[model samples]
Target: MARFLLRRLVTSVVVLFGLGVVTFLMTQVLPGDPARAAAGRNATAEQVAAAASRLGLDRPLWDQFAAYFGRLFQGDLGTSVVTRRPVLDDIAQALPSSVELVLAAMLINVAIAVPLGVYAAHRRGRFADVAARVIVLLGAAVPVFWLGLVLQLVFADRLGMLPLTGQLGFGREVPEITGMTSVDALLSGDLPAFGDAVSHLVLPALTLAAAFIAVVARTVRSSMITVLDSDYVTLARATGASERRVVIRHGLRNALVPVSTIIGMQLGWMLGSTVLVESVFGRTGIGAYAVTAVLQNDLYAVIGTVLVIGVVFVLVNIVVDLVQLWLNPRLRQPARGAAPAPAASLAPGAAAEAGPAVKEGAVS
Candidate 1:
């Protein structure tokens, strides 16, 4: 376990380093002088030069990168040229909404996918399996923006149900200590606030989760098909174990590694889709924050926010890796460490000395 964690920690660090370099290069390649833009057209060359110097923008590229990274370690994302507020502060305010959205969407995905996947795998090559595949294809093919618009049209415009825009409405205030309105409402014992929050959340959550549902279901179905054919699964059935027990305990348990990998990868998809989903619903979150930052040409804000996203992306995958390791310890352990004969002790010459009892037991 320690070795596995250490390995993942190193990998995460390397990934973050690469992300920082890429983000820095992207900022460098953008058109126009960032300092001049920040200072406005009326500002003299002297003012622009001063602004650039203050921002470390006038420094050598390597020195600038070093300085930016050094500040990042101390949790200073630098002041946004556009907002004149620390980018970290802005992210702190907006991050919760994105977190809340993604977390809720994942729950929705799991709730729908697990059962559907299991049923489809069990009924492989039949109607249910084909339907599951079709669902997956549609989910993958459909654009998130288009889906969000259609959802808004059908649910908000046509039916006049569900909130069309914003995370909350008039006179519904919950202490956003946790940054999630629903949780805040629950914490404050405001039932109506919670209800309103859910009503607002339903459409966006469904739209975001729709893509993941099919992906997760298809992955699960595929994993189950492979696992169900394994020797232990067949052995479980031969021993008169209940179908449910055999399926869950043996088949699904061993499939955790692949399932978790898919789930972790889906986190990236969820983050990318948030830009459209939040924009469509007019939600104040990191995705919307990112868009605003870009529009204003806020260099520091964009870099800071994207770096934060990269950190989150790395961390979530690390968590998934840990979960997979726990689900299957053999993943970390040496292959030969797993023994079918736990009770039988072998002598130095056990193979040559083995007789009827050992042979019969092994055969059985």
Candidate 2:
């Protein structure tokens, strides 16, 4: 486990490094120059040049990379050209909103999808199963922006049941003790603020979660079906286990590893890829922050945001791996313990390290 975790950490570092490089180069190759963007349109040539020089854009690309990399190591994400604030600070402020949004969406998705999936699998090939399939198809087929718009139009604009925009009511302010609006509101014991926060969150969170729930439900349903048909499940059934116990304790428990893995892998996607949802809902989050950075041609902000997203992706995967190992102890063991490596299979250096071959039960 230690070795596996160490290996994963090293691989994550390499992946994140590559992500930073690719993101930096992509942002660099974008049409508008950040320095010029920082300088107003009315600025003279010398003023633009001065801004470029100040931002170190006048330096060689490699030099700029080195400086940026050094700053990254020191927890500096550089200053946002448009906002005139540290990119790090902006990210810090925005990250909580994204976190709150993603977590709420995932919770909603799992709460709906998991039980529905299990029930669909339990009644495989029945009306329930077909209905589940249709739901998944519709959910996956719907575009995020269109779904968000339609939701707002129906629930907010037409029905007037929910707020159209923002994370809270106009006048119902909650302390930012935690960055999450609902959480902070709840913590502050402001029932009205909390109620307003939930009202504002409903459409956006549900819209964001819809596709994810579909995908997860399908995956879970398939895995559960296979688990139900397995020999152990048959044995459990023969042993006079109740149908519910057989399904929940035996089938669902064995099937959940895959579902957990999928959910974990989607965490970053939920958190970082909700740009359209955030826009439609008029919520201030990392997604909105990144969108602004891109529109303003703020290369530093773009790179920083991308780096954070990449890091989150890596971290989520690590958590998934750990969960998988915890749920399936067999995953930690050698796949084929009956076979041992032959001397000829060893590389020259490994061969040198090997003293001699031994009998199956004998110590060398």
List, residue by residue over 277-315, the lDDT tens digit for candidate 1: 999999999999999988887877888888888898899
Q: Using alpha carbons, what is the TM-score of model 1? A: 0.90
* Model 2 lDDT tens row, 1-364: 9989999999999998888788768757878767777787678899899998987889999998887678778888878888889999999999999888999899899999999899999989999899988987799789999999999899898999999999987867888987999999999998888888988888899999988988899999999999888755665565565888778877887789999889998898898768888998999999999999888778788888988988899999999999999887667985685765554332222233233322331364
Can you give the TM-score per candidate against the true fold? 0.90, 0.89
RMSD of candidate 2 to the true fold?
8.8
The clash count of every prediction, one per candidate, is 0, 0
Best by the lDDT measure: 2
What's the C-alpha lDDT at position 116 in model 1? Answer: 82
Task: Point out where model 2 deviates above 4 Å.
Answer: 334-336, 339-364
Q: Candidate 2: what lDDT?
A: 0.84
Report the Cα lDDT for candidate 1: 0.81
Worst 10 residues of 2 by lDDT: 345-354
